[model samples]
Each structure stands twice: as C-alpha cells, then as structure tokens.
Target: MHIAQDDIMQESYPTVLQLYKLALLVPQSTAVVERGFSAMNDMCTDLRSLGQQTLDSLMRINLYQEELLEEDLELVVDLFKNKKERDMPL
Candidate 1:
C-alpha cells in the first residue's frame, strides 16, 4: 500500500494574528504611569504650589535629562547665564 502526500500551504488564522498584534501594541506594564504620577506628586506637594505648565515642564526635564540631574550646580548656573545673554553686542 502506497500513501499519497498532500502538499498544501496553510495561511495563518486572521483572528489569532490580530489578537497577537493587538497584544504587542498594548502596554505590558503600568510602571511608566505610576512613575509619572509619582513625579507629579513630588513636584506638587502641600508646601509647594506649581502651575500645570510649570509642573509639566519640570516633569519633562526630570524624566528626559538624567545626566543634567547629576551635573554640577556651577554648570547649570553657567548654562542659565549664557542663555540669559542679550543677542545685541554692547
């Protein structure tokens, strides 16, 4: 007895593939959200009053400028000094 071999290619299931794609698109962790809330709380404590824009700016700088956070105070002061210089020469 000889058995015939069926050569057939099967397409991936659409629903399974879509579900997988959706899973990848969704965030796996809430850590980022928690960190953001924590940062906001730290910036807006009872003793300190910060406007929404100011708080957002501070949070952005704190989150993005990890290296700047460690920089020397003199360096930061110098940056502000240079930034404050007038464009017109005396």
Candidate 2:
C-alpha cells in the first residue's frame, strides 16, 4: 500500500499495486458513492459546459469506483458483525 514518488523507490511499492487501494479507500462503500453522487449532483446543478471526453472519463472512474465499493461492501460489513448478531440481520 506504500506509494513512493521516487523512481529509486519503485521497488518499495508492491509488485502489483491494488486497482483500488482498500487501505486508501474513503467511506469505502456504496453509501459513500451515493453520498458523493448526491453532492456532485448538487454541485453541478448550475454547471454550463462539461466536455464529452472529460465526462466520459469521469463516468468510467465513477463506475469503476462504484463497482469496487459494491464488491467490498458486504465483506467489510461482515467484519463488524458480533457473534450474537451473526444470524440476526441478513
């Protein structure tokens, strides 16, 4: 999970860095994505011009992040489960 800007330290970083670093992941869940989209929607409510290329790239990143978050959401929530609640809320 280490990221070094120095070319010499390239080996310090993992041989294969994560596609989406869970350690660096923020809010790291679908809830955050929903919140972010809500904020972006509100922020851009008055936006005039967004270029097609920029928009497409944004769409791609958003989709990738959303998918990553969704995929990890359940496994993460499970980590907080208590033995008593193991079979409580599914």
Candidate 3:
C-alpha cells in the first residue's frame, strides 16, 4: 500500500489568523499616553490656572519636543510676547 503525498495547509480557525495579524499590527505600547498624563500632572498645579487652549498647546510641546533648543524656545517666547493682545471687554 502506497500513501499519496500531498502538501495541504489546514486552517483550524479562519478568523484567528486575521485577528492575530491585526493584533500584531496594533501598537502594544501606551508610553506616549502615559507620558502625556505624567506631563499634565507635572505641569498643572493648583496654583496654575491654565486655559483649555493653553493647556493643549503646552501638552503638544511637552509630548513632541524631547530636547528643545534654547534658540527655538526664545523664538517661542518672542512670539508669545508679541502675540496680538485680545481686548476682552468686561
């Protein structure tokens, strides 16, 4: 008796392969989120009353700039200093 040799692949779970592929593609790290939270905690204190827009800008800078150069910071400061004054009527 001679057994015929045929190469055949059997997928026990069809969806498992797709799910596993997706799982591999997704980011497994929460470091960026954690860092943002940490930065917010550090930056915002009871004494500091930061507006929503200001806080958002600060968070963006903190999260993106790993090492900000002094010249870049000076430029930022100059821009803020020379920013158009909003005359809010009380």
lDDT of each: 0.74, 0.60, 0.73
Candidate 1 per-residue lDDT, tens place, 1-90, comes to 211121221134556555656777899899989999998898899999998899989999878776666776678778878896658877
Q: Between candidates 2 and 3, which one is better according to TM-score?
A: 3
Most accurate candidate by TM-score = 1
Which residues of candidate 3, in runs, are more than 4 Å off? 1-14, 25-29, 66-90
lDDT of 2 by residue, 13-80 (tens): 55534433545666546886786577556434565556768665665666578787789988877776
Superior candidate under lDDT, 1 versus 2: 1
Quote model 2's TM-score.
0.24
lDDT of candidate 3 at residue 4, scale 0 to 100: 19
Instruction: Point out the worst 10-residue segment of candidate 3 by lDDT.
Output: 1-10
Sort by TM-score, best first: what order? 1, 3, 2
Question: Which one wins on lDDT?
Answer: 1
Q: Candidate 1, 50: how far from true, in Å? A: 0.5
